[model samples]
Target: MMKESLCEVNNLGLRYHRGESAILQGLSLSLFKGEIVGIRGENGAGKSSLLKAIAGLLPYQEGEIRMPKEVRKGLSYLPQDLSLYDSLTALENLIFYGKIQGIPGRLLKTRGNWLLEELGLSQKSREKLSALSGGMKRRVHLASALMLRPSILLLDEPTVGCDEESYHRIRDLLLKMKQQGTGMLLISHGRGELEDLADRILTLEQGKLREKCISSD
Candidate 1:
């Protein structure tokens, strides 16, 4: 069966300032429903910039990105930096983000509870975000992103600071989401991580991207 395409980027080019070197150029990629595409690159590579462009956070000077209305409406971006308030509890943060997404109060409550339990953070749901460890905080941020049950998920280093258990839990959750038909673009520096989670892996270098050849062994 042919997979449905959720988004497409054609010949994308980006630069923060005029006359500066392009952070990304001539990049083209397509994401299919229920597919996980992994991007690997060094620190200075334009991986994050590519994601931001797709998320509509950055303005690109060249090329075009096509996302249908349904896909755009259901898109979610989880940046490398956690975007939760340290002053709010984990549950409170979820509620806050849900409201911002215009989710109904009752539905938000139900969804938030389920996400907390799924992430093994139900016990810490009411704990202030400032008190949570780095891994716990990352989980909370992830839960907030999942609040929308997005059709397209852009994850930037979702397991960067995660411990062994946390990493496994997240990996499992991502696979579950994939099974549920969520197309994802994940950014990571770890080749093993991508090999384990992504159906296709692409490496970004010098503002360009190429497919990574995996060993059959």
Candidate 2:
């Protein structure tokens, strides 16, 4: 069966400043429905830059990102840096994000509560984000990203700083999302995590990308 293309990056190019080294050059990739694509690279290899460009956070100097208008409405991006507000409670943060997404107040409340419970933050729903541990904060971030039940997720190290149980919960959630046909572009330093979750993995180096062989051992 042919896979449906959710997003396409064609010959993308980016640089922080003119005359400086290019961060990404002539990179092309496609994400398909229900697929998990893993990106691996050393520091400064522009892994995060690529995701940022795709998410419309960073503007690429060359090439283009193509997606259907409807798909754009369902896209979600989770950066490596925490994007949540420290002063807001977990539920409040979700409501804030959900509202921005235009979710109705009644529906947003229901959705926020559901996500907090699913990510194991139900007990801490009213706790301020700053009062939570790193793992808890990460979970809340995930919950906020999930508020819209996004069809495409650009996740940058989604499990970083997570406790063992929280890590497993997230892994299971990703699998479930995949089963539900959510396409994901995931970046992780752990090779085993990529091998287990990604249908295929791509390595980024020298501002380019190449398909990598997965070890069976």
Candidate 3:
């Protein structure tokens, strides 16, 4: 069976200002549910810009990004910075984000607990973000995103600063989400994470996305 496509980007173009060089142009991409796709590129490449456009955080002048009316309501975005609250505990942060995502009050508690436990952060549930290690913070960040049971996830460098165990936990959590039918678009510069997580990998250069095979190197 063919999977349903959650997002469609057609002839996309992104520019900061009129009469300036385009940051990205002639880009098209499709994301389907129950899949993981990775995009890799060099420093100057517009990988982050592309993610911003897809998330509707940035305006695109010359293209269209279409999502199903029904499915549009359940998309989650995790930016590169993680954007977590530094002073809040992991549980508190999850509750805040769940509420913001419009999850029901009682349900938020249930989902938040499950997410924390599943991410192997049950012990750190009450730990302040400032107190938790880098890996635990990343897990908390991901927990916030999954709180609303999103159908698709947009992740940027999800395991960048994670320790070995934290990295495995996040990777495992992603696999679990995939089994339950969540589509994920993650960007990473390293090949190890992409090689293990991505079903399809693309390299972005000069505003173009080219499919690429992961090398053993």
Candidate 4:
């Protein structure tokens, strides 16, 4: 029997402003459960835009996006831009996002602490985001995204600016999530990382989607 797709995008099109040429045009793809789908392309190849559309962060002008309603309920997105509160600590940031995501109060506290410890931020849990380095901020942002235990994860340049240790931690965590049957849409420019982690690689060029098979080492 064939595996059911967690996500499907067909003839998707989007433009930032009216009459502007579509940033993403006729893009189509399917992502299955327990798979890490990587989107790779040049700087302006609409990789980020495609992710935004799938994540419901951007409105598309055309086409269908199909997903299990339950999976859609569990979707979590981490954008390339950092959006943490400058005055809040790493743990506080996680708590905020968790609460907003409807995580129970008791579970939020417990999960926040656990995530901070796991991400190696326990020592600086009280330090304000303003005091953290760029890499640290990125880690905090990623931690917030993981706090909800999302079944479908959409990550845009998740490892960008991360230190080597932090990068490995994030990479390993993603692998573990995939093993647990989480569907992922990963956008990255790093060929090495994509080659190592993605189950299927999709390239967007001139508004077209192409799949590239990658060997798993």
Candidate 5:
């Protein structure tokens, strides 16, 4: 039996200005539950734009995006840049995001603590974000995104600036999420990691998407 698609983008097109070239043109893609789909492209190739559109942070001018409302309900996004509050501690940031996602305070506290511990940041949870190393801050950002156990996760260059240990930690967390039926669209320029981790690889070039098989070595 074939797996059902969790997300579908049909004939999608987006342009920054009217009558200008489309950043994403006639693109169609699908992600199935429990699958990790990697998106690869050069700079200015609209990879991030595609992710933003899927996350509903950007509007497309044409085509349709079909996703289960339930799956989108707690959809999480980690943009290429950090989204945490600089003045907030890692635990506080997770709590804040959990509240925004409507998670109960009691559950938020449990999950936030577990996440920090899993990400190797339990010791630093009380420290302000301003004092964190880049890698530590990125881990906190990722933990914030995982607070709600989102059904669908959109990660844009999540491993950027990550140290080896942090990179493996994030990778393991993503794999664990995939096993728990969380669909993901991971945008990255790192071909080696993409090849190893992505179940299906999509390459965007000149406003088009093409599927490529990746050997997970």
Candidate 6:
């Protein structure tokens, strides 16, 4: 049986400004439920642009991005910056995002604690983002992203600063999400990470997307 495609991008194109060379062109891909699609590219290859377009953060100049009706409301974006409020504690940060995602106070508290513990940040839960190490902050940011139980997770350089334990924890979490019928589109610089986690790999180069060969397990 074929799994449903949670995300579809057909002939997608994007540019920095009018008449400028396109950063991405004729890009097409689909993210099916329980699947992880890994994307690789050189700097300024439009990987980020592609994610932003699917996330509706950037306006595409051509083509379409289609999400399943059921998934339309359940998508999450984790950009390279891992945005978090510098002044807020890890727990406070998750709670803030949970509220933004419409999670009730009680549920937010429960899920937030679970995520922090799962990601190895429970002990630092009360530490402000400014005080946490880069890896710890990244983990906190990820905890916030998962707090809402999103159906599709869009990741851009999500493992940049993670240590071995945090890296393993995140990989496990992503797999867990896949088992739960979530689709993922991941942009990563680490070839090994992509090989271990991705069901398929794609590369963006010269303003187009094409299949990239990855070593088998």
TM-score of model number 4: 0.93
lDDT of candidate 6 over 162-217, digit per residue (tens): 88877888898888888998889999997599988988899889878888656363
| lDDT of candidate 2 over 76-123, digit per residue (tens) | 999888989999999999999999888888899899998887778889
Report each candidate's C-alpha RMSD, comma-separated, in the order given.
Answer: 1.8, 2.1, 2.3, 1.7, 1.5, 1.7
| Model 1 C-alpha lDDT per residue in residues 100-125, reported as the tens digit of each score | 98888989889998988888988998
Q: All candidates' TM-scores? A: 0.96, 0.93, 0.95, 0.93, 0.96, 0.94
Each candidate's lDDT (Cα)?
0.91, 0.89, 0.87, 0.87, 0.90, 0.87
Backbone clash numbers for all candidates listed? 0, 0, 0, 0, 0, 0
TM-score of 6: 0.94
Q: Please report how far candidate 3 places residue 10 from its true position, in Å.
A: 0.8
Worst 10 residues of 2 by lDDT: 208-217
Model 2 alpha-carbon drift over 4 Å, by segment: 213-217
Record all residue pairs in model 4 with backbone atoms less than 3 Å apart, i.e. clashing: none
- Model 3 pairs in collision: none
Tens digits of per-residue lDDT, candidate 4, 78-138, equal: 9999989998888889999999999999898799888777777789899999999877787
As for TM-score, the candidate ahead, 4 or 5, is 5
lDDT by residue for model 5 (1-217), tens: 7887889999999999998999999999988889999999889999999989999999999999999898889689999899999899989999999999999988988999999998889999999999999988889989999998988999999989999888988888889998999999999876588876799899899999989976453
**How many pairs of residues in model 6 come into backbone collision?**
0
Error in Å for residue 203 of model 1? 0.5
User: Candidate 6, which segments miss by more than 4 Å at Cα?
Assistant: 213-217
Candidate 6 RMSD to the correct structure: 1.7
Q: What is the lDDT of candidate 2?
A: 0.89
lDDT of 6: 0.87
Candidate 2 global TM-score: 0.93
How much RMSD separates candidate 5 from the native structure? 1.5
